[model samples]
Target: MTYRDFPMPAGLRRTVPGGSETGGPEAGGTVAEPAPAKASATVMLLRPGTGTDGLELFVLKRAATMAFAANMLAFPGGGVDPRDADPDVPWAGPDPQEWARRMDTSVEQARELVIAAAREVFEECGVLLAGPDAGSIVADLTDPVWDEERDALLSREQSFAELLIRRNLVLRTDLLSLRAHWITPELQPKRFNTRFFVARLPEGQIADDRSSEATEVLWAAPEQLLAANDAGEHRMLPPTRVMIEQLARAASLDDALRPAERVWPVLPAPVEHDDALWMRAPIDEDGNGLPPTVAARNGDRPQGELPVMTPWTGGPLNERVTCTLCPNPSPMTLEGTNTWILSAPGADEAVVIDPGPLDEEHLQQVLTDVAARGARVGLVLFTHEHWDHAQSLERFGELTGAPLRGNFPGAEPVTDGELFEIGGLRLRTVLTPGHTMASVCFLLEEDGILFTGDTILGRGTTVVAHPDGQLSAYLDTLEKIADLTTGSVTTLAPGHGPVLPDAAATVRQYADHRQERLAQVREATVGQQDRPRSELADLVVAEVYAEVPRNVWPAARQSVLAQLDYLDAGS
Candidate 1:
């Protein structure tokens, strides 16, 4: 296994993961492996001949011994070679100037990068994107005479374009389009200004991966790949993960190809704090729109007067914010991932709470917004260390230079009664265990808001995750939160979904709902013939939460396990 270590250009300091302006948040330890910088390309190859053939991406699994992407699934391309810049080759479409302007590189350099990308694609994948000479009995590129030229070019004995010109083959710039760019975050020594590209696999040629960089290769549909990744069945870098997620939404190859031609630049934004680190891409174009304004978490108007939310289906992106820039009724996955921007009321130096996912773009938008406010981020407060929420902490903190504060250890976990001061706001931590042992919620005195990670949510019921998520402890924690609401809690801010108007009512509903589910599960299991755990879960899910998706039954089984443990303890 060959391991390549590519270093970044000198004098450029590595800041946050996603090209964020550094020096706000304290540095967190490196999160994930430091990705080696390489000018690699991910070709989203399409076969336009038959619509039924669908979209197929050429993919490779790096050899386990390779230094950069060892043992990982990847696209077919590698670092740029100097020979790719030769000026003698017959050209296809767009001139180098257009690419240079778009890529923000010198015309000479941009030409070389594109050449390298094309050359590497052909050499490793065996898909010759270059055009065949007119009226030739055989494709000039496949001729045995050209093998020496190809080998010499690969070995840096000759220029790629010179090899092409010597054999009268045309370089197919027309076949490729710029997709996005990614830079490895600064925390690690290895970095690359990787430029991803897209192209169609030409006619009469099948991909033959020649490099030993990858141990295996396959061409799979985007949806299949994303499913495998989501199910923890495949490994993908953050960029690959996001692109696959985006591509899965498209219906056909044409739909996917149209977007790639638009030249969207993927900005690397890694947010970091004292305790965590991760990367995300920027969400939108910088300086193209007005900066978002931070809204007070607690509104002055009454809950009934607040605009009634018609359940949004376009996911969290389309959700509307009430008199604030942050989305209200933030859409969430089953686990209830609630995200909030904690700005000082009428002040700029606010804190961001629970920047969800290691999404590079969203983190970049966050830093851009923070910078626009004329005040940098002061802190990133985590509600818990669950994979869904806290994974991006290190990146967010590193980008903003803010100290991270949470209820768990490392860096600084807020004590059961510790108070955190950010700008003019004060957040009091309540050590509410259960719903996964270390769960904690924060009471924002400035906004009268409670930021609950997963101990509570605004919609649906939270299951005691079992073993790790204890039922008894969770129930006890709920009772305690209910106690707070009964006294002064007016609004409910949960980790998942939207904020609620009535805190006390919501807490009571949560408690009652869990009890109801447990009771139903208990009834279904009692005096029945012994059954497998999967069978018991299926029966209990249908009986208790018929509204929940059947696909989530596996998750429900964990909850059912806890409920059974509680019932058995009493028996």
Candidate 2:
């Protein structure tokens, strides 16, 4: 998308009332550099609105006495505390390492960001974003006793972690999904590198207007807030404005709380362009001219690419590993099929995995690369029978003069724990069948890298191709993978997208996501068990997957049907 950047003139009035001044570089006067942005976290607490309305977001008006964004409409948040980063904090939900990877920060920083978000929400609105355990949120915090705790927290008498521990509570970090990251413009005197998180307002918990920092607090539908901003009746910082605009698009609370496909850290800067001052941030190549803020919300921006050893066409990934990207790119395949070449250091023979679709050029490219490495193909392996990964299997076999092997028919079937030594490199097969009945993953024992073929994708969840692909079996398979290789596997070389550095965390997330989706599907289908199964699947998709793109719903429908089948069979 296109984003304009220009210098902020010294006297230009700020569009957002109560926002910091946009003055910088006074005409012909010495210019002062802006201060560094402090790390901060903000939470948008949301709940379902009355009747057919959408989500209502909790917003606060900062007290006019505040030094920054005084009288501005905003969410509950503030800078992180050193104690927030304490490693000993009893946490519940996704681990900090997973959050760290998702937020593009360190593990300690991730923990601190989550703690800051939850703590600030409680301090500003008297709503605790914590639970008594990993799976349950604390239902009520309106008692007078909680007021004392809140006061203690605000007064820094005890850290948030200490308060939770004393009360036997667990911070439900899982409830908070990162929505966006924004850095205040360079010209603003007070800048914050803020991460905005969205969370459902905990049930039975009332958000009181007890904060000394806020002049007012109210719950308003996102559309209403956006309308107020458009009419100049309400003032918000640029990041807040953008977040509200994005939230306004959601049709319901479920839609609003859908996990973001990607999070882009936007650093808006003022620059001189076209004889005028304007603000700009980097536009993603696929942004299609939408503003960077909007593009980020729409998931158009590529989050971050994996560290590639060679060009997109393929080359050496490391001293002993190489990969070639197949020339097929689509909505599902991401970049293309990844055909990896694995060999032991200084070895004369290598194993070729997932030769990919039967494209003559791609096959030739693979052969050329292998020959160039001076390593003859010793073993040709297939992760599955999927055309993207195995269509060229026979051709590859003929070209390399190596036997084809996999879990599929007409090849040497792979057994669980089956080991093979190819030129000093050790390989073992792990049966991971649910993406397809024949799907499998190969682990390089030496380096602890698992080559997962569609069982786990590089970016999004893999489709559980129904009929043949059962949801129950898939969940079991994911658990099996997690158990078999949690500590041993260091990286994941998937058939698509980028290589995952933390295999255990990624697998755990995948399992959690599936379980969450199953729960959602069950909740949506309750009391409709007597309906026709086919019609029920469509209904589940309509009710539970409203925010999913229409094009992908067909595939999602298959998954819903599988979940329904699993539920029905159990009942």
Candidate 3:
């Protein structure tokens, strides 16, 4: 709505939605220096669409009565206001300096662009892209109080900074992923330098049709929009159309949010196509100047060796598997718990594994993601009852109205060989009791992949957990997992960290690490078996786990205790 001709600063030419970018009388007409493009931001707001993993992107059709890019479809965005550069604006996520490097702009300009992106979306659609803090996103703004603030922002009576500070909120830049940069071809009297961004529809927030510039606002999946455009149903620019093309390739909404590795700027130029005038840019199919190397989903030595995994924020692992990273990251919880959803291709029913911790936002994220997939939670299964994995169990049951089953206290009983068939997926339970007496793994009969809860991790070694976990039983479970990997399993979706691409090798590495740690414990006890258990445990941890983080030494101590119990070491 703010784009009412989206008044921009002088410079950057405009490539009309379906018009020519070739400018200044290319056929020898009089020419003049192009005006400087106005600084602007465009948000490609996305959400899970119904009945599939494909994502729905939000778009607005500017009313023909409006000034800028009128009657053309665009995302929520507008020219940057000077007030947006205010240093006092509440900020969170990556700092301006980092954003500067990422967006190829000055720190001050980067700050303004980010704030403008967040602000324009709110002013136009009444959907705030910010929250009370960096780690949290506002869920709902349906209250009348929010409407008042939205009005204030739109009218410029209150600066975006003042509104945020007054509400004690911060612009959650971390929620934004910079996709590409584009400059209008240098022939237009009014031009724009726009930064394109993609962000998920934050939980609890909905896109309302309230913008002043547009007569239409809707959310449709990438393919749906493309098909509509092809049919002359939705008119759009090359940038918007190309972006939709990219979204069509995304396996899930999470995949769509992954930032391009290198964002080279794009300026649409006119090209002759089949004797017809066309606007073209150097953007690739993935919406970049070239193919992008997305952030690695695996940490150092992803599968073969035991090392902490990279921060895998979660995405579609395959056609049927999706991981939603919880917000609870720590030394113990790698990168927070990974709540997994399993469904068959195009099935209406799905199976959820590990609801994860009780963070309200996380629970809603999982639920919202499931809805996006357009699948009903047919069954909820827990790998174990650790709070990190099952704390939200009952709350999830309340959210989905689905049956809950697992080895946990309140869960209905499941057996080692119990098989479940849902939405065309065949999952078999493999009782894995080393991490806990009830820790289990689910083998996806179709994919030959195993959901190895905490019994095995994608990165680092899992704790036997002492009293609750036994080294002997755990060792046997590893062997079982290894045997499956040797046969049908190829990938491992761990409870924490990235998915292991090499399941056989990863399982073998886990088994070998356990044995190696046991050997170290045995050697550390030489002439020290007579020492007190605490002292001996500390000694073993210091000698064997010196390379591991001290913060996780307590968990290592548990493993040491399990090893001690198995070896009958110390009193």
Tell me how far the alpha carbon of residue 272 in candidate 3 is from the true structure, in angstroms, after superposition.
Answer: 37
* Model 1 Cα lDDT, one tens digit per residue, 308-416: 2233222222111111122322212422345666655455677666776777676776676555555677877787777566777778777777888876654476788
* Candidate 3 lDDT trough over 10 residues, lowest sum: 20-29
State the local distance difference test value for candidate 2: 0.73
Q: Please, what are the lDDT tens digits per residue for candidate 2 over residues 1-571? A: 3443324422222221111122111110111234346679999999989766687999999886554576789999988877899887779888999999888899999999999999999988988878878888888776789999988887667889899988998988889998888876654434577999999988899988999888889998888898897786777876787678778877678988876677767766544447455555544442112344454432233221111112234556677788888988765666688999988767889898999999999999888877777888899889888788888888787888898899887578888889988867889998888877888889888787899978876555677777777777888898888886656688888787667666776676566556657766787776788899898999988765543446556776777777888888883
* Stretches of candidate 2 exceeding 4 Å from the true structure: 1-314
User: In the order shown, what is each candidate's alpha-carbon RMSD?
Assistant: 21.9, 19.8, 26.1
Residue range 1-571, candidate 3, lDDT tens digits:
1000112211122112111111011100111233346679999999888897478889999876443455678899987877889999888889999999999899999999999999999988887878788888888899989888888776657899999998899888898899888776543433578999988888889888888789989988889888998787887766777778888888888999999887876654443336434444445435565222221111211111221112378889888999988988764565678899999778899899999878889888887888788888899999998898898888988998888888878888799889999977999999999888989889998898899888766544567777888889988998888888778898888887677777875665456556556665786787788999889989887765543345556766787888999999332
Candidate 1: global Cα-lDDT?
0.58
- Per-residue lDDT of 384 in model 2: 86
Residue 150 in model 3: lDDT: 81
How do all the candidates rank in terms of TM-score, highest first?
A: 2, 3, 1
Worst 10 residues of 2 by lDDT: 22-31
Off by over 4 Å in 3: 1-310, 547-549, 569-571
